[model samples]
Target chain A: MPDDNNPIPHWQRQDLPPMLSRRFEFETYSETRRFLDGVAELAEAAQHYPNLSFGKTYVSVTLDADGKKVGPDLVALAQQIDSLVAGTP
Target chain B: MPDDNNPIPHWQRQDLPPMLSRRFEFETYSETRRFLDGVAELAEAAQHYPNLSFGKTYVSVTLDADGKKVGPDLVALAQQIDSLVAGTP
Candidate 1:
């Protein structure tokens, strides 16, 4: 059964040399689609992409490279995504 | 510092809705290179690639998708790579 949070079901994490992975999500289909495009742009710009898999109601990404800006990309988006999924932010 | 096993240095683990990560390593330049190409092929075939970073002496991969086969690709290569790195296989 797929839900809004676990888009990449049957996924497993691996220690990527020096990289870590965090999953992100959104509330609605529109929000999820927006996030997909925005993140794809960011990854293309930074030359860093994640293990991305999406559904109509949800989206997720797993980090696997040298995340360039922890402060700007990872920290900001993680918090934002967390809030959306949890209904707090 | 950077050894063979921990290639992607600043990595952290996140709860991927339903994902887990395990690291794999290899020894020697040629061996590492072979493993890289082979794994890349598997990723391409399975449509599931790992977070890859390389060095002169080692290679590593992090899983982030529904691993095609716990019995075939993932299991076979993971064990082979590990044995090569640990000097046991």
Candidate 2:
């Protein structure tokens, strides 16, 4: 069941791999690069790094669970990542 | 036929999408981040951006062809990327 009030609704949850992932699209490579840089800084500050893949206009981010289940910390991290482009134009 | 003297022998050529791709592994996330920055600089300088995907210790890069085949320019770009880690400890 999907939560209607999920803070990071765009992110998909995986069970077998115990991961949460999302793909963000941008209007240009510059925007994509900016988002990536923001994620890097956030990861550095939180000490929680995620797998990131990007092309000219999109970035795919995967957050792995340290334990068997996706915990609150991971969810909070995802919310922070979502905030990177939350109100951007 | 494989070119024994190919400058970017590590990069694999794909026909369907007309792309040249390669994966580079690093000893640490810091090294991976450095290589990624170098690639970004090279792409900006050459105006030829490649698809980049990375985790904590590896980066996968893909260069797409503008036409039917991977051209010399793409090969040159791959060579430059390879140089970013060549002969380094």
Candidate 3:
């Protein structure tokens, strides 16, 4: 068994793309809204939208399918949106 | 930036906790049912159970809130039962 102290590290945002489902954490409401807008654009293009739940400072999204690849693709899109938010673009 | 070929690793079953929400995948219907049973026991005990969606061979659960600690504590309990299934007990 993995040791408790040695508990595995959470999958970083970069690693989250390929999950079966995803939940994103953000720093503020505008950030959260902006991320959703980016995802909305992708959804409009690919027609592969996800289920969304918005919180005060977070947004949780789950895909319609459980395929391994679906999670990460959506995560990647979200990360792209995040980069747009971070002024790294 | 990370490479696409070297995509970040998916959060292992072990590292999934401490997340605000969680989703679990299993190998078989029996296995999925069994895991849900274990979670049920914990829910009965803690009264902090989650929302559940039982698929053919997978079960997805999402928490009511987006708190970090809740994700991992529950994941830890699920791991205990997973170890039991793996003959590690």
Candidate 4:
């Protein structure tokens, strides 16, 4: 069942890979770059690095779980990533 | 025949996608981040963005040609990317 109050709404949970993944779209490359930079800083601070793939106007981030299940720390990281673009102009 | 003096030696030429692609490895995430930042700056200056996929210690970059064949400009961009790590400590 889907959680009605999911903290990380944008991310898709994958069981096989045991990861949370999300693709963020932007209108311009500059916007994408800014978002990428924010993610980098967050990763550095959290000491949790995610796999990132991007093109001119999009970034796909994948957070892999250390074990078989998605943990609270990973969820928190996803929430932080979501907040990177939330309420931004 | 492969050119003996290929300027973009690090990149592999792909015909189906008409792209040049390469993978760069790093000992640490910080090194990968620095290379990514350099690529971002180069893309902004050259106005040519490449598809980038990275993990904690490696980045894979792909430059898609506008037409069916890879052009001189794309090759130049690849060379410039090569220089981003050349002779770097």
Candidate 5:
């Protein structure tokens, strides 16, 4: 998990953006869309959308502050998405 | 609307690929994500997902048969997405 006081862990950092990024794999398009649905819900509720790219079996989600300083809400959003994928929330 | 027997209409054809592509604009991130949620549902129900790209105020959806011959499902999926955006269903 990522928090404000420490450097984001490698497992959590996308390391390529001023944003948090991650890729998720699915067994089928249906499964992938299910996950994307969760992301869409999370983003809408928070009013903080991510850049989403997806295909038959994979999804790549990228969230950037668009040149602003990264904030806790973004980190929390990433965690929420991860939890959604894990099926625990 | 795109169909099986005719060239896809200019109003409907994305014009850039062996795929159908289009961009949607939103007034806010929340609105964009709401649209994306609809797309996710449509894709999941049909088992055909689009390549989705989005940001704060815009979304771009691209769908390809992925080198397979374009089929009715693909065309139908695109229309459903459009209608979903239009809030008709």
Candidate 6:
């Protein structure tokens, strides 16, 4: 888990809806599928789900704080998922 | 399956990226999850994948024709998924 104080820099912060969003590129569909599987696992464990959308070679993610202003916890979870995605082959 | 010539009206069409995108709103996390499950099944059946993202009460979807111009096939798939999502409780 990443420190809540320091959010991942790669994720673009958005305020229109108070969320953090990013798109992860992949080399193949299989790789993208694996990354999504990791995200599913993370969602199940944390009970904090992010909107995850993927194409043949990319996965786009958006994290919202469930009606609250986007907070550190959401950022940290995004960072955690980023790590999980990076860890995927 | 819907007619290939006619697509769903609610889905907004975009040409910059050659894709069709829509966001579906739900009343609960469980509803969102169920909608996602239906989407997964649709993906498996069509062998066509869409970028699908969901927050606590909404699911956003984008469908691309896999490097080709957004065609009837992609639009049809989106329409198909739209029906599946609408069917979810």
Clashes of each: 14, 0, 5, 0, 0, 3
Candidates 1 and 2, the one with greater DockQ: 2
Could you give candidate 5's per-residue lDDT for residues B1-89 as a string of tens digits?
Answer: 35666533322454345688878888876687688778877877887767878787888888877776667878878777778666522
Model 6 lDDT tens row, A17-39: 78888888989877877787788
**Model 2 Cα shift for residue A42 (angstroms):** 1.1
Candidate 4 local lDDT, B1-89, one digit each (tens)? 76889997778999987999999999999899899999988888889899999999999999989656999888999989999899853
Spell out the clash pairs found in candidate 5: none
After superposition, candidate 2 runs with Cα above 4 Å error: none
| Per-residue lDDT of model 1, residues A1-89, tens digit only | 55666432333434434333544545665575566557545555555545454543445566654634333454444444344445432
**Worst lDDT window (10 residues) for model 2 chain B?**
B64-73
**Model 2, range A1-89, lDDT digits (tens) per residue?**
87998878889999887999999999987998899999998888878889998988899999999657999889999999999998853
Candidate 6 lands at a TM-score of 0.65
Q: Model 2 TM-score?
A: 0.91
Error of 5 at A65 (Å): 1.8
How much of the true A–B contact set does each candidate keep? Answer: 0.00, 0.85, 0.00, 0.96, 0.92, 0.85
Rank by lDDT, descending? Answer: 4, 2, 6, 5, 3, 1
Candidate number that wins on lDDT, 2 or 4: 4
Cα-based lDDT at residue A44, candidate 2: 83
For the second chain, the TM-scores of the candidates in order are 0.49, 0.90, 0.52, 0.90, 0.76, 0.82
* Residue lDDT tens for model 3, B1-89: 44465211222222244432345666765575577567556655655545555543555655443344445555554554344445422
**Residue B50 of model 6, lDDT score:** 79
DockQ of 1: 0.03
For residues B43-83, what per-residue lDDT tens digits would candidate 1 score against the true structure? 55555545554443444355543533233444444444344
- TM-score per candidate, in order? 0.31, 0.91, 0.32, 0.91, 0.64, 0.65
Worst 10 residues of 2 chain A by lDDT: A64-73
Worst 10 residues of 1 chain B by lDDT: B11-20
The reply for model 3, stretches above 4 Å from the true place, is: A1-19, A66-89, B1-89
| lDDT (Cα, 0-100) at B60 in candidate 3 | 61
